[model samples]
Target: MASKVIHAIYTDDDILLQAVKQVRAGRYHIAEIYTPFPVHGLDKAMGLEPTRLAITSFLYGLVGLAVAIVMMNYMMIEDWPQDIGGKPSFSFLSNLPAFVPIIFELTVFFAAHLMVITFYMRSKLWPFKEAENPDVRTTDDHFLMEIDVEDHDVNQLSKFLYDTGALEINLIDNK
Candidate 1:
């Protein structure tokens, strides 16, 4: 297979939208899009599915809550029951408010730590891993659209990008 460079046209939001619309209407293949920040409705425009990270965080928080409850109960009531400040440790149901702080801390701790781990894992980002950045400027103030042209007309694609008011155009070599 012959390796070819994919040219990306960078522009503002309006131009990006126009280019995306035209590409969609023409049924052109879009490789990827890079934006400085999350654009509203861009995911819908790109037909992306919702992220499941929030759900995963909730589940992990629940697990933390369970762990907090089990550990506290086992320590305070079952293994070594202790009476502090005249509060009875006979029942976990009683003085539940007292354990609220531990529960809350654990919930936040587990959710935050686990969610970060999950996000890194899912995104394939790991410690000491080299970051794959498309463009340094794109991280600050640029919108990039990458289109794959498989047996497609390069002139037509270039024209479309130019007509849409692309500020810059560059080709990416994909091996």
Candidate 2:
């Protein structure tokens, strides 16, 4: 299958931002955009939903904490029952001070590692993956917005994009 896309190029982030807003306001569906750097408010302008990574991190931390508690209790109380610091109570909660460091370290370690893994998976990134950037200039000084020409007149859309401050525009077919 083949599809047509319009690549509207911009020299300024502000101009690209305004073009995106205007294009969206006119009920046009933008397929994607590429920029040299992160543009503030771009996600909000694109109406993307908020991510739930914070919640996932919290859960991962809990899992880490639980593992810490279980491992510490089994080792210190149930298995060996050490008498460190002359406090031989032989109880898990009684010796909690000795396990605090492990608990904290494990919690942070699990949350950070799992969050990174989740981000990579969600973004479809992995080792040995080929780059998908369409234009090398987008990584330098240009911003490119890709719009699908599904049912609209290409001439009208290209003119509208030009009016929105696009420095250059090109039509490409993708399969």
Cα-lDDT of candidate 2:
0.91
lDDT of 1 at 104: 93
Each model's RMSD to truth, in Å? 2.2, 1.5
Residues 137-166 of candidate 1: C-alpha lDDT, one tens digit per residue: 778888888778777777877777777677
Model 2, runs deviating above 4 Å: none
lDDT of each: 0.80, 0.91
RMSD of candidate 2 to the truth, in angstroms, is 1.5
Number of colliding residue pairs in each model: 0, 0
TM-score of 2: 0.94
Summarize candidate 2's per-residue lDDT along 84-150 as a digit string, tens digits: 7798657888788878999999999989999999999999999999988888999999999999899
- Clash pairs, model 1 backbone: none
For candidate 1, which ten residues in a row score worst on lDDT?
A: 1-10
